[model samples]
Target: MSQTKIGALQIGSALSSSKVTIQKVLDYESQIKDEACELIVLPEALIGGYPKGWDFGTRIGYRKEVGREQFLHYWNQTVNLQTDDLKDIRQMAKRTQTNLIIGVIEKVRSSLYCTTAFISNQGELNGVHRKLMPTASERLIWAQGDGSTMPLIKTENLKAGSVICWENYMPLLRSHMYSKDLNLWCASTVDDREIWQASMRHIAYEGRMFLISACQYLGSPSSLGFDTEWPDDKELIRGGSVIVSPMGEVLAGPIYGEEKLLSAEINLDDVIKARYDFDASGHYSRPDIFKLNVDQEERIKN
Candidate 1:
């Protein structure tokens, strides 16, 4: 590919009901498609909302029985692989010929996973990567993902890879993607402005890959269950979605306190230029001294 124009849905957290949130995603999809974006990425847990922790209990007045019931209802309502909402997204992708990477709460049997689905331009579901490890309060709601589903998805323009939230902190995980010769790294996170932007920069520089780091800002008190009496000094997630080039340059907005669709025209040739200097998994590395074994066979086995 010559140049790829990518878009990111920097959406605000929605109410736990599908009827309430799915329309917002559709609206965002329409807006991004109109911009002639080739790839569109949504934030982590965009379908079921984020930080579904004890705060959810607090939002519903902290009644254990009622909280459990609400949790069950939310889980039941949102746990889906092929819902009408996704059908609309598929149609949009088909019409626009844009690939989609959307984050959703995936229900597998009795477990719920923090998942991101990759949909091709032809509206085919390529694959899904569940968050390897849930962070802090999130562990209460989501189960950890196994190594089975963590393959770097091959697209026409790039070998793309993803890791949700705190998984970005895992050096081994980063190395795993690097070992696969990933050209594009999708870091779907739920962090604030400074940290989010910093992490994107760090990952871009470290992995020598184009980084599409998307984040969501939790502004509404009702959405995250923070009382109005809570400190105004603290911002939940100030959506700092950014597109970092292989040279660690910010191509899009590190936006704060608003919902946005950030886009960037990425040249695939940049990957070639960067690798000419130092390909971490290739020529520049000293694998003769220390070797890291990444078993690609296990991915195909599953």
Candidate 2:
């Protein structure tokens, strides 16, 4: 597996419903068929929606009745893994012969998790990686994930895995993922800040892996009818989707204020070449001096 083509689809969820978003994804997959991407990564929370400025009506110490109602509505918006219509998504992947890594709000009983689903080219749901630590306010809505769901998917073409959104900031987590000898690192995120690009490049250079960061592009606030104080003309989440080479070179984009699919052809040889001087998990790691311990226990059993 010397070279392969991968793509990152940057688009926001339909504010109306998950079904609409699912259709949007299916339509995009059809349009990109000619691009011939072996692997496609969709933005985080694409199925369930990101809920940009909503606070869920919560504050310190007191949880209001309105908050509870708001929470209930949000919970209803989550994807039920056992009952939801994921067949279409899987079938789409098979039709295109493209592997997919997509983010969705997963509902497990009463709990909701920010999860990334991995779909193989055969249209099988291979595995899912839940966001271990839901950043800041996200903790209020999403339950923290245990390590039991961490997945490193090995395909005939490449060894791939994902770190959702801000998880890229965790040094120890990066070490754990790097130890798996991954060639492709996928990041499904909604963080559209300029600083986020730097982190993507840094991680690619640090891990000596091809990195794909897919971000959401929520257009003008008024379009979504979101209840927020920001001006109606302002963009909610401007996209910054991008792809980076093992050497931290920008291969695809950091396209902003628009929705687009960015693709890059990666040569696996570059991973080895970039690591010749520094392999974070191999030669460069002084095991005698430092070590990392990971707990893979399931926090909640269904």
Best by TM-score: 2
The reply for model 2, stretches above 4 Å from the true place, is: none
TM-scores, in order shown? Answer: 0.88, 0.97
What lDDT tens digits, residue by residue, belong to model 2 across residues 253-301? 9889888888988789999999999999999999999989999887766
lDDT of 1 at 32: 65
Query: What residue pairs clash in candidate 1, if any at all?
Result: none
Winner by lDDT: 2
Error of 2 at 18 (Å): 0.2
Q: List, residue by residue over 86-186, the lDDT tens digit for candidate 1.
A: 77667767877888888888877667889998888888888888888898767767887777667778767778888897899898888777888888899
TM-score of 1: 0.88
For each candidate, how many residue pairs have backbone atoms clashing (under 3 Å)? 0, 0
What's the C-alpha lDDT at position 168 in model 2? 89
